[model samples]
Target chain A: MTTDAAVELAGVTKRFGDVVALDRVDLRVPSGVIFGFLGPNGAGKTTTIRLLTGLARPTSGEVRVLGREVTSAGFEVSSRVGYLPDVPAFYEWMTGEEYLAFVASLFGLESSVAKKRAGVLLEAAGLAGVRTRIGGYSRGMKQRLGIAQALMNAPALLVLDEPTSALDPIGRKEVLDMIEALAGKATVFFSTHILSDAERVCDEVAILDRGRVVANASVDEIRSRAGRKVALEVAGDVERVERAVAAAAWCRGVTRVGARIEAAVSDPGSAQRDVPAIVAAAGAGLVRFETVEPTLEDVFVELVERAS
Target chain B: MRGFRPFFLKELREIARTWRIWVLPSIVVVFALTGPVLAKVMPEILRSMSSEQLGGAVISLPEPTWKDAYAQWVKNLTQIVTFALVIMLGGTVASEVRSGTAIMVLTKPVSRPAFVLAKAAANAVLVTATTLLGAAATWAVTLAVFGEAPLRPIVQPTAAWLAWALFLVAVMTLASVLVQSPSGAAGVGIGVYAAISIASLSRWAVEHTPAGLIGAPGALLAGDRPPLSWPLAATALIAAAALAGAAVLFARKEL
Candidate 1:
């Protein structure tokens, strides 16, 4: 908290014609962490990235990255930042190594050092042995090369838009590992519709819905905000069991299946203490009783659905 | 112009590695070789055709000269090479934007002005090199075919045409920025060219505007000196203005 923030947006509102893409969205990401910007398609995640990268201007608000206002930075601030769009494109005639070298030249990297750095990055990206032109590459290979191209500068802040959106399971895992390896070296802000990928690597996440930010906090804190859910299974009189808990002070809502009942509880401690006894009094043997924690996906769906 | 050198080099490499290298240079080479040969054979062709159509009627026609050969070369370069040049350079910025390649470069420390000016400079080199190559070929062949041809006469007209071609490069650069598609940008370029040709029909327009440069090449090669200062200065000013306008507007576009 003492260090300066990596990115900050205050009351950012972007509109394309009459459609509002992002509406008064405000967020702050601290430096030296992996932050996730999670949303479904059409949730304005890319719009936010465009503003931060100076590819776009907001209808009304301030967008700052690494402590400099975006529009003012123009070219100078980009030296310390790297970005990968959702669909990264390249010159079809260029070989993988040639493209990286071109990117390095833009950053003013020396020839000798640039080649070595490019080799190391290509190796890390799993494209070291490939010598074909970029036009001949598959989608996955292109994505790997894209990651390599973005790292040519060793930027202080890396912004990625859906880095794993097109990868297979194994490829996604390797990319996630690469992102996990970059936790302290740079501030990695990545957006994804896949909640599990964000859940796996992010220290904090913000869920956006319908052009609005519904939740922004650490993973555990957001999970806690979904409250606690309890499921109980009994031998007999499941309807009586549901009736007993539905009227309790701690229970928020209850749903009964054929022989089991699930309920949301405001106080997990009170529910754990009282639910078993209440079920026994309703003449049903308590076969199972447990409190379940919501996964990040469950939390995301709950938050987004509630906002909608 | 923070990243001008590297960006410009990349553009040159792109031109060499793609189909762009083949189109303009090949067009000029073909025209340069054939223009003189066609000029030499035209009188005989007309005599042969008229003998059959006019039933052996006598005819008097002047002998073709190196001037005819040189004029044919200039006409082809101006009418045909200019269109090819337009189609070739029209997508300089638009294709990059559509293909998302601009995003890759613009995200670096490269300035917008540098991105646009790099394309302009690199394509200008291509246009200049090919035009000069064609002119040299025509000069050598015209001398060989006609037994006598002056180098100064050939050089003057080619220089004027080169000025107009380079100005078209700047026009296409701005067109690519204003229009998002390659063909659409080329359409804008051709429309401007047609407009200028039509406006040049006026005597005053030919004497004062860039339309003057369009016909200046033929007149200069025939050993007639026009008031060229106005057209040359106009070409330079307009080209510079188009480039500066492209840079300023591209900087504000929401990619």
Candidate 2:
């Protein structure tokens, strides 16, 4: 792996019985970026996490993390990689402090070191002074503890699986904020179906659909892929205007549904020229014309729908 | 250390807050106290009932003995305590999956093998403690009621019980690894037990093969006359190890 690549998957394939959980897929996560793996459930998000963390091996592929092949993966990367499972499981008997200490022992840390580090992590994750048993912790508190455990070793790459799915609105915000705060300290590759969480924290994202990554790029690169769309609600003669707009070589795909005309244009500058001429020639009264930029949710939904 | 300590402690906490911990112990304790009392009084009670119906007819009944008291305790364990033990440990991994708790631990640096091993070790400790406590209580009560017959060396029986306890723990661990829900694990655990029991019953395997570990515990408890051999002891130990290994392998297996 290159110094810039915190995680790299080359032609990874995972099969579950007869079903293909992940197809021959490749993903790259550069250093110091919060990368989001956005897909609906069973879209290979968890499978990818399993493969990367060595929880499960890929049927055929290579996974490299922190400049090492994941062949001896388990605890090697565990120290450098913190993971928050989609719904983290914990020992309800432990207080937040005790739970962190248990995770620290996995790293072979001294008792004093583990306790000190766990104390810092608990406070950082905003779980300080919570003396209740984990059984009594709210879903949000559990998620916070999950984050704290994942980050306990001061890992280089933190992989979280749908960490915010169970949290309330405010809780979700806090978790996302915690992730964002760790941007420079660790590389986070978290999977989420919640687009807003990804939008809030992720600088990079991959859209997985049907066991393959349909779109993998920086947030801006994907936003740029679908280009821009101009929607027009003309008062009269929409078909004539759509036909006129369709005849323009610059307009890529044009569709007319009732009075609303939608066209995918490569350049908004060309639309500035064609829209007015068509409306004037067809004697159509332009009710509203608006340019809509694609959102991560829109791109994700469109990509998944098109791939399937 | 990894997921095991955290997960094990978590289970202990769950047992404390819920009614299950109290319920399981209370039931065991009740059986322990009642076994000897029931044995001594049952024959006379039945005789009195018969005399009342038959108008004071002379009736002879077999006197209850120390053997009967121990037999009653074994029967309770085989029929009821065993079921409860299976239920308690069956959900070790299942409840985590259902609650989305497994996701949190497995995604960490903790290997799936360690997770399964931790569970096996923890549940084994809990079950063994509970079983022995009940056994000890019953033994004490038997001494109090029967005035202590010549104490026989119990080395072999103690070993067998320990083996059985470990076997139960391994089986329950395997069950948890195979299913995503507690109910699913319990069903599969029963199915596994049934399969092993059926295998042990086949005359072809019992005479020529080392498969009797599955059946020997019950056979011995039921008063079957068989010499205790090293092969039988080894079979239990090996089976326990194999089941634990399988649990580790399956827990690490991808979902």
Name the top lDDT candidate: 1
Could you give the TM-score of chain B for each candidate, in order? 0.96, 0.79
TM-score for each of the candidates: 0.93, 0.81
Docking class of 1: medium
Model 1, B1-255: lDDT tens digits are 999999999989988999988999999998998889889999888888788888898566789999889999889978999899898877999999999999989989999999999999999999999999998999889988999888888899999999999999999999999999999999999999999999899888888788999989888987888778988898899999999999999988989
Every candidate's lDDT: 0.91, 0.76
> Which pairs clash (backbone N, Cα, C closer than 3 Å) in model 2?
A80-A155, A88-B104, A89-B101, A91-B10, A92-B10, A93-B10
Considering chain A alone, what is the TM-score of candidate 2? Answer: 0.88
A1-308 in candidate 2: lDDT tens per residue? 36569999889888878999899898899988999999998799988887777767888888888767776655667668888777777767678987887777666678988888988888877888889989899899989999998887888999898989888999999899899999788899999999988887889999998799998899988877775888888988778888888888778888778888888888888897678878988998988888878888878877888887
Two-chain DockQ for each candidate model: 0.78, 0.39
Query: What DockQ would you assign to candidate 1?
Result: 0.78
List candidate 2 segments past 4 Å from native: A1-3, A40-42, A92-98, A109-126, A131-139, A165-168, A230-249, A253-263, A273-294, A297-308, B1-20, B62-67, B92-100, B146-160, B171-226
User: Per-residue CA lDDT of candidate 1, range A1-308, in tens?
Assistant: 22398999889999999999999999889988899999999999999999998889999998889988888876656999989999999999999999999999999999998999999998988889789999999888888888788888998889999999989998899889889989899999999999999999999999999789999899889888886889999998888889899999999898887777889899999999998899889988999998988889989998998888
Report the lDDT of model 2 for residue A308: 79
The chain A TM-scores for the candidates, taken one by one, are 0.93, 0.88
